[model samples]
Target: MLFGPRPSCIKRLLVIEDDPLTAFDNEHTLKHAGYDVVATVDSGEAAVRFIAAEQIDALVLDLGLAGDMTGRDVARLARDRGIAVLLVTGRCPEDASDIAMACLDKPHSPSALVAALKALETMICKNRAPRKVAGLTTWWRPAAA
Candidate 1:
């Protein structure tokens, strides 16, 4: 297996953020946290193509991408392909729970990001809902799924 059954299934991540600084920071942080960041792209189009070509375990998606395709577009494709999505939204990002695992609002700490991902990993692996996280609102409907 590419990844083992434990520690963990959420190890491979694809970061899709338009802001170069944010992308770099996220990549650095996730790497420091021991995740194998597959790639960091700044456009939805690129994200889509990359997802089609790679075996990513999850995504850190920014809704306000600078490309022909929107982040929602990428999320839909990723979800349909059974890849987990972690949304990164601004102050008023559209609620896209239908296509995402959870939403993490902007101006959040790196620890919060890591917490959210761990929560997501638990939810996916255990098939249970996650508890509340700071600056995060989960829309995962595990039972319904």
Candidate 2:
């Protein structure tokens, strides 16, 4: 009997956007792209809490949040935990380049967002890291050590 290869693991994603409509769009885009959006929050504080409690594969964050903590702060925390991060913002910050894997401009098309996420996913996979930003039939496997 022949059997197919093992299935790839699903990646869990967290989205943080202050605007309800924008947050909804992000969630929809991620889900439509085959990512499992574990949770969507509007404030940095909530994002931090969610990160602490969940095994997040990646984060899709907005720079300006509803709480005292900024998206940069959350990104910093996530990076420290080895979680991949992508910043989606209207105005990209000079410092964002240091914390996130990539920064995406606002008003982006869903396809653009999916592409960005796929790029991030590729980066993470290259490092033997891992997200569900897009459905990729071909994935990069890390070379043998």
Candidate 3:
């Protein structure tokens, strides 16, 4: 039998923000928190591709991206792919869409984002068993940890 140790539990995240300053700040903070930032893009289109390519465990998505597609669109796509989402934006509550994970308004401190990500990570970890949602069973760990 081929026996090997389970892979490391490094969490991967994708950041989709249009503002240059915000993107830089978020990338710096998330990296400092030990998340593997797979990709940082200014457009929702690019963000979608990054999620598709990487084993993205979560997303720190902005509500306003610099492209025809909005951040909500990116969130929806990511959710469909079983990627946990954390919405950070200055937009109003009513503007929020059907995101699965935590949501935080913009102008938030790095600590706040980190807390939300941690909660999302815990939620994902607890629900590692395969679940059928929307008639689809998304990829999830076997609670081996």
Each candidate's lDDT (Cα)? 0.84, 0.77, 0.70
Worst lDDT 10-window in candidate 2: 1-10
Q: How high a TM-score does candidate 2 get?
A: 0.80
Candidate number achieving the greatest TM-score relative to the actual structure: 1
Per-residue lDDT tens digits for candidate 3, residues 20-84, read: 99999999888877777888899998997887778888888888888899888888888888788
Per-residue lDDT tens digits for candidate 2, residues 1-145, read: 0112211232799999999998998899788777889999999999999999999988988889998998889999998998878888887777776788777778788777777776675565555533433322223345577
Error (Å) of candidate 2 at residue 3 is: 27
Q: How accurate is candidate 2 locally (lDDT)?
A: 0.77
Candidate order by TM-score, highest to lowest? 1, 2, 3
Q: For model 3, state the Cα shift of residue 86 in Å.
A: 0.6
**Leading candidate by lDDT:** 1
lDDT of 3 at 90: 76
Report how far residue 68 has shifted in candidate 1, in Å.
0.7
> Between prediction 1 and prediction 3, which has the larger TM-score?
1
lDDT of 1 at 41: 96
Model 2 clashing residue pairs (backbone)? none
Cα-lDDT of candidate 1? 0.84
| 1 or 2, greater by TM-score | 1
Question: TM-score: which is higher, 2 or 3?
Answer: 2
